[model samples]
Target: MRPAYKQILEAVVVTAELTGSELSAHAQEVMVDDLMAYPLDAVLQALTRCRKELKGRLTLAAILDRLDDGRPGADEAWGVVARALGDESETVVWTEEMAAAAAPARELMMLGDKVGARMAFRDAYERIVSDARSERRSVTWRVSPGSDAERRVAAIVRAVELGRLPAAQAQLLLPTQAVAERHLLLTGSVMTEQERRAGREHVKKLLGMLRGGKVQVARTAG
Candidate 1:
């Protein structure tokens, strides 16, 4: 880890202690390594949000989980994290050289081309997901928010939310979005098969509600 990251981790550990929480030395190192993947400010913001929102004892894993929750700059800083896509049998891992290919999307976003960025990301992401699915593997990791499929959904969600894309697209993306959100929540945690099935069923309900229409919007009182 970089000296600066170690310094930040130390500061966070001290702050956690002041807040009546304890951060283990090993945990602190792990958090710093994971966080160093993003811009410094984005990592700090995630940590700050965790400190403000979590009650009771603060753990390093909890803070890292908060970062994965699509908090502000976290998603933007997510970039192309699809390091490797593992097969269903777990026998092989397919990796994509994404950073260079995905640079256009990042540039477009930086240039205020929200639509172009979203489109670019979606195109690259969908292509990746298609390959992964064909190999009978879930998108292992590609960025924050979850798998490549989930990231694709998130890209559409961002565009729609920004009014850069039509809400009609929401129906198409919401199902995968639900799956992605659940998959993300389940990461680094243990759960039963029943619970997993229940999660999928819950996400499926969204399909019926979204069918044949753009997402519904509530009107405010005039």
Candidate 2:
């Protein structure tokens, strides 16, 4: 453990007024080991949040919950998956946990059991998220493109705007003309017909790669 972490943990312990055997050297070592997986800044912020909000004894679980780790709650994750299920032409940017839970949910949805699919998705998502958090795995966001070109462009743009996708990487998933057009529009310029044709060819290649599973869009670390 870093000296800084040890100092912060001791500070948190004092602020929380934790007494008894909980302040033993062995217990502190265990806490440091568990917290070492997270970033120092995140750990500090979580401890600060715990200092302000915890109503009961400060526990590892409470501090973990307070970390801004970017993992969405089960209900929020389900909502994203459920929207994708309803729209075949909707592009989605999701975490690995959401994708993993989505498989079983999609299977149930295919059988016309929407309710069952939702319940299963929530349960699986929670379990997967818990395991991921325990393992100190950060969220990785990936794009799953849809068939609609316009919608795909819109989704990618929105993701980049929201900081869910990096702008540089999003360019790989978009057509050349789409990017050019957006740039031109922002600069009050226009795209030529030749440029449009070139963009179409780029789109075709992207679509082909997507079909072949050769285009693994960039993964954003959360």
Candidate 3:
């Protein structure tokens, strides 16, 4: 297979699995310059790892040659990177442990009282966003037929829990069937025992917000 094709496939697999996985903190870093987009270093690492593990399946020379030739979806790649590289996004410094995760779990205080809102992690992956060719890169479109509900639900909730989306807005992005399941999973699976107790205390808050009325469910995350 062509190096470009392999790169694209690897990106799709990683992106699809991102919902339940983690991202590193470097993804959150501010654009220090025009070049400050997707983590090439990490992508390089990934390619190298693929080469090492796949042995006969993938060759480092092929990937390296492609990288040098700018033959591996360079034009198509930049757009994905650009999306993740929004202007002036603030990124925290990277740590060794952070390098190990897909991306860092970021949080910032919202609301006047400084309640925490989670931030997106590795969703801003370099290759996914880099579309130098400016091709229309729809990661969702690449998902398998009939859609993958579990991945979708987890992603929406994560976006909401993180400051990437308004809770209501995130709710609207969910599929109708996935809504209840996601809420329960979030209200259950995401908490530590103490955190769960605190969240339960805010059951009234949850209901009150729900009382404002639900966001219309959509078929996909925009």
Candidate 4:
């Protein structure tokens, strides 16, 4: 099931259990809408942990508590939920743990600060890469794109190294370009000149964004 749907079902189930009053269909829909702003994986994981470890019972309060626990596994998910819940409840205040784990990137998006958002995401990428190297995990990208996102990421990083693109722009471009690349690779032999030209033009447009500074980067941390 989609995490959002699962969470909605579980929340209602938990509410009914704790209150002994079935939440009306309208109420259930409203709850789903509220929770939908959160990242699905985090919400689903929090719900699972809340049910399993929090006395095999669940409630919105219980789930919120689990999210607020700030334990190792829960911290990131909690950060995600906290950002989504932003100032909606008097009980929910911004916490340092949530900020460290998840807030900067989200806050930037909320403030219409795309440049700041890119910097934050780029920082996360650098941290993960550093961590992977320290742990001796393979950091090399494979030659072909395949299903290897890391390879695409590595290719993007390489572009940064070669001065072909900025790290932020490369990261932003690769995911979209990867889809285009996959399409071309899959259909290249059968593609007509016009089709190939169209694909090339699409790629040119993406690269143009980077060269033309269509996306911005921050000069200092915000």
Worst 10 residues of 4 by lDDT: 89-98
lDDT computed for candidate 2: 0.76
lDDT score of model 4?
A: 0.49
Estimate, for each residue in 110-213, the C-alpha lDDT of model 4 and write its tens digit.
78775666567446543543343334343232122224454555555554554444444554546655544444334434566676678788888989888666
Best by TM-score: 2
Candidate 1 residue-wise lDDT, 1-222, digit = tens: 667697668657865775688667777677677556655765576578766777777765555544432221213422332221211211111123243335557667667676677677656655544443334342222222234554456554554544444455344445453554434333524456786678778767766676623434333322
**TM-scores for every predicted model:** 0.31, 0.67, 0.21, 0.26
- For each candidate, what is the lDDT? 0.50, 0.76, 0.37, 0.49
lDDT of 1 at 49: 74
For model 1 the local lDDT of residue 62 reads: 52
Deviation in Å, model 2, residue 214 alpha carbon: 20
| Residue ranges of candidate 1 with Cα displaced over 4 Å | 1-3, 68-222
lDDT: which candidate is best?
2
Off by over 4 Å in 2: 1-7, 11-23, 45-62, 111-113, 181-222
Q: Which scores greater on TM-score, model 1 or model 3?
A: 1
For candidate 1, the per-residue lDDT at 10 reads 68
TM-score sort, best first: 2, 1, 4, 3
Q: Tell me the alpha-carbon RMSD of every candidate.
A: 18.4, 8.8, 20.3, 17.0
